[model samples]
Target: MKNQVTTIYKQAERFAEITKSAIVSGNIVRAKKCLALAERLFATGSYETKNAISNVYVFSVSTFMELRHCNISNLFPQSLKAEYLKQINTSGV
Candidate 1:
């Protein structure tokens, strides 16, 4: 039981790390315009456009969808959101 608890804690820590990395490395604009653009692309973009975003961030379709869902989950607090927003805005994304 102790081992299981420790393993679960480690997994949660790793998940938090990955979540931080994802927020750091992507242009996470969850605004209406960005969502609309994403919606339009998913609706009608070419395969190449579907293949990559700015040729830097790439995820399998369902993986990206899951990522989006996780980002908007209650796990993302205002402080983290503010930090991520500041980061991307400063980087001029």
Candidate 2:
């Protein structure tokens, strides 16, 4: 379980990095896809792993929000939006 969580965390981090690169290249679709994969990986981890990846997730989401120009409210997945909202509420951001 620990190894699996660690693997997931590493994969999420890699996806987060890929997401940043995609955003820099102005590839919103690729960035969104990577962010979604990262979020799903984050969700599968244990509490400790989730906490460790929370910053990465937050960074990825905020970067996406800033780079995306379309109607993101409709385009963003509800699950990820909910997670973002929950993080904001909890962190008082």
- In model 2, residue pairs whose N, Cα or C atoms come closer than 3 Å (at least 3 residues apart or on different chains), thus clashing, are none
Cα lDDT of all candidates, in order? 0.40, 0.62
Off by over 4 Å in 2: 1-14, 67-75, 91-93
Top candidate (TM-score):
2
User: Each model's TM-score?
Assistant: 0.27, 0.56
Please give, for residues 11-92, the per-residue lDDT of candidate 1 as tens digits.
Answer: 4334334434545566454432343444454346566543332222222222444655654433333433343344345654
Candidate 1 clash pair list? none
Clashes of 1: 0
Residue 64 of model 2 has an lDDT of 60
> What are the per-residue Cα lDDT tens digits for candidate 2 across 35-84?
56656656786786566457665556555666665344553566666666
